[model samples]
Target: MSDMPPSQARSRTKVKPMTSKGTGESDTGGVRADVWVWSVRLAKTRSAAATACRAGQVRVNGQRVKPAHTVRAGDEVRLRQGDRERIVVVRHVLRKRVGAPVAVEAYVDNSPPPPPREAVAPAGIRDRGTGRPTKRDRRDMERLRGLAPKPHE
Candidate 1:
């Protein structure tokens, strides 16, 4: 048998619990749907996050939830960002600022497969063979097409 120093043995304590049991505050088990998305670095702003929920762009447990919707551990979360969509399960709740790596610990991924990246026709635009596009229309078209890429000679 190998013998190690006593100090090293003592330092091997149990993992630190997320919350202090004796204290008034217990660990944040789960968080609001919109809030969790913002906390997990999904949506940029809380307002935008809420907007997504209000617009029915978010779903929980296969049901469309509201902006003020509450979520807890084991609940599934589905959200979309541009062309990519994500599905994650709530593992914890947090309200304060945290590093990206640590913040992700609050959830587990159970995402669905992304749909095929077919050429999407953007709104407010006529066909390619239509009349000349307006300045705004030109910019919009450029942005849409730019989402993919042009072929190189």
Candidate 2:
């Protein structure tokens, strides 16, 4: 303060590290379930994560937990969204959301591989601006879906 300029003095002041941008670990020992899910990109939004928790789609260590439940390192977290389920173990407790690469480091994923594409039936698509399907078009669509009987050769 005695010898340095104002700019230099300000620059010398201790700066606090940001909680939002780094290793995903916080000073706190644990993080909330919804916040953790959203931080790791498991849920699209914080509210969505909470909703899933309320619906019993999220489980911690094989037991269903509320959105406010705390998650600690080494705990298993299971999240089910529609037809897919994700199982992960907490490696680090994150307080804020980070980049994809950083988020991946916070948890160890143990989800099963997705089913083969061939096992899923393809849906018939119609071009935009096209009117409703005619009877013949509807029949053809049904046949493609395996919902209508096939004709003899």
Please name the candidate that would achieve the greatest lDDT relative to the true structure: 2
C-alpha TM-scores of all predictions:
0.56, 0.74
Candidate 1 residues 26-75, lDDT tens each? 27555678877787777888998899999888998988889778877778
Candidate 2 lDDT over 1-153, as tens digits, reads 378799988898898654544565775568899999999999989999999999999999999999999999999999998898999999888988788998999989999987899987777789988999899888888898899899668
Q: What is the lDDT of residue 25 in candidate 2?
A: 74
Q: How far is each candidate from the true structure, as Cα RMSD in Å?
A: 13.0, 6.0
Clashing pairs in 2: none
Model 2 stretches with alpha carbons more than 4 Å out: 1-22, 139-153
